[model samples]
Target: MKKNGGIRFLRWLILFAKRFLKDDMPASSAQLTYYLTLALFPFLVFLINLLSYTKLSTWSLTEDLLTVLPAGTMQIITSVIRETIEAKSTTLLSFSALFALFSTSRAMNALNRALNKAYRVQGTRPIWKNAMLSFLFTMGLIVLIVATLSLMVFGQLIGEHLFTLLGASVYFLHIWNLMRYFLPVAIMVLIFSLFYRFMPNTEVRFSNVWRGAVFSTIGWIVASLLFSYYVNRFGSYTRVYGSLGGIIVFLVWLYLSSFILLVGGEINAVLLYGDSKIK
Candidate 1:
């Protein structure tokens, strides 16, 4: 029997996606992503509103940082920040004081459960224990996140300064290319480290965390770019759906974030599930 080339290609693609996506791959990822996003939706809304009230979004700080970059690059970064802030909605702010810690913890439980369900592993952490762990871990995570932002900020500053001093130096150009690769690794380490330190039913392996973080972080960046492209090209939802656009976009991003969280669980499962290693 002659195999159809197109169908054969499709089958391989499906297998490839499943291997990387893990278990139910896209479907499982999507389920956890959507569920967790819906749960965390209000927190995001509150934070955005908080940022608005503080007028932090209109740029008092990045302007100082941008002075070192060429006008063109500076303009692009500033423009994206400006447009994103301006597009934010005030109605979302009304829900801020309404957030309950107890409820939020439950939402976190949902995330934990989603990951467990996807991989068929039982998570044994008590709710209070996981919540405490998540909270303390969040402080470290936030610090690392802030440090990454600083690294990124200082990185551009150094680059701009180097270009000013070195002008056409070919060596400087090569080093700049190297920064791109190393920076992503650093960012992924922070991301995966947080998940490793916090997400497991038991203590997690560092190697598992690293793989999950690196893979999922890369997936997230690619997904976000594609999502933006999609919204710009095919979605008129902001104008068409109004406030609901905020909900939809928020959901989309959260869904992806949750999926990334699950990837850490999947990695842990790959290593620790069944057999004798876990004991």
Candidate 2:
């Protein structure tokens, strides 16, 4: 019993460290999706701006309706963009034109693997189909952002109303303290629904998706906060590197985001695997 216990402890520790560093597993198909996500984020943002009622700047509908990240975050992002554009916007734009075709292939394969969670192994898709599905995924991404922003607005309104009724000061104390927790929970719920509804491969139980969603979400929030802290502290990489530093920041954020997502997938698979065996 003690021997088994030791092994379990070691395993848990290893997993925690991986959560901290978000190291990539080379063979993972999802890793390609990570790149695809990075390569595609800007394009998707462009599409969302054209189609949706939002711009990437202030009063962004996407943040209010879909992505609901905190205020002032966009300003940091804009600073990054401006710096990048000043340096090599044209080169990056040309590179994006070339990468759009190949990098998305990695993403399509990764999404297929995820759909596999819903059912049994299936045949591969044609290139056109992957593009179509990827496009659909892109649409879903916009809706998701809009929903988040909307919820954030609604939540803030409610929190404000409650504070007024309950002697604003004390209520304000609690609301301010819990913003991080509530905002992330809202996002987790949104992601859980997105996966449950859209994934095309198999029929995953709503429960499994949410469990994975929550796991992924918590990991994402903590990791991001830590990254911000590290960036502020030892690295101060953003300030020293100036606009160039944003690339480093972006790479770290993207890689870590991918790792958190995969960890959630791993946890979901473990739970599903156990359930299958028991049945």
Candidate 3:
């Protein structure tokens, strides 16, 4: 039975690979990278402008972003924010906000198309409806980012205070420390699951999508960590690309992220629709 199970798993993996290549995910990921790169700076500007109206500090957001983004990429982003602040032009801010909204919506729309390809589904939604949904998704994504930053910034203080009142043990404090790491991971899974469930044109059950969501969350974290390690320890993009090195590295990282995200959708597609020939 164990041997049969192993064989079945191997066959499934092979089928997945074949379909992944057939879908030309690498090209699709490149397309996503383009839209994402275009949107990224404007989104940052929009975020900075929006934060000016709130009490939240940009430093918190930067720290959170650094957890996933390379230090070089963070430097670029931080420098942009700094320059934006120095300029302090109300018109630039206003334009950035509008442009950010439109570009981010386009990025989300591109992502929707890619995922549809993964699931082998046609674009059923009308252009206007798709545009509105993408716009809403972009807004929700911004809220999610802010909420995550807020949780990371304030969660510990709240936890400590509550634990003090309860007279929690030292061991409980250690567990809470562990939860600090888990919280971001949990949020990642939730985000992936939500996107997988709703982003595609077809109806996807929660049960069918959970596996892909978990796979994507884990794959993304692992890929980011490995990429970060290699870039920091051995890789020298600056030596090869000079001043544009940071941008190159950032694009590569985004491509990797895009590939993994779509692969997760492919996983779900295979599981839901692939034949049981192996079994």
**lDDT for 50 (candidate 2):** 38
lDDT of 1 at 43: 48
Among all candidates shown, the one with the greatest TM-score:
3
Minimal lDDT window, size 10, model 1: 270-279
Residue-level lDDT tens digits of model 2 in 1-279? 999999987775565444323323333434654655565555543433333333334334333332222223334555544444344445555555456544554565575565453233464556677667666664555455555555555556666667777766775857654783476467666664565434545456777667767876777777877776666556765467766675666556666766566556555544555434221
Question: Highest lDDT among the candidates is held by which one?
Answer: 3
lDDT of each: 0.56, 0.54, 0.81
Report how far residue 158 has shifted in candidate 2, in Å: 6.8
Model 3, residue 69: distance off in Å is 2.4
Clashes of each: 0, 18, 0
Q: Which pairs, if any, clash in model 3?
A: none
Each prediction's TM-score against the native?
Answer: 0.56, 0.57, 0.89
Q: What's the lDDT of the predicted structure labeled candidate 3?
A: 0.81
Better of 2 and 3 by lDDT: 3
Instruction: Give Cα distance to truth, residue 174, candidate 2, Å.
Output: 8.2
RMSD of 3: 2.9
* Candidate 3: tens digits of C-alpha lDDT, residues 32-115: 788878887887887786676668777775677676677667678889888776676678888987888888888888889888
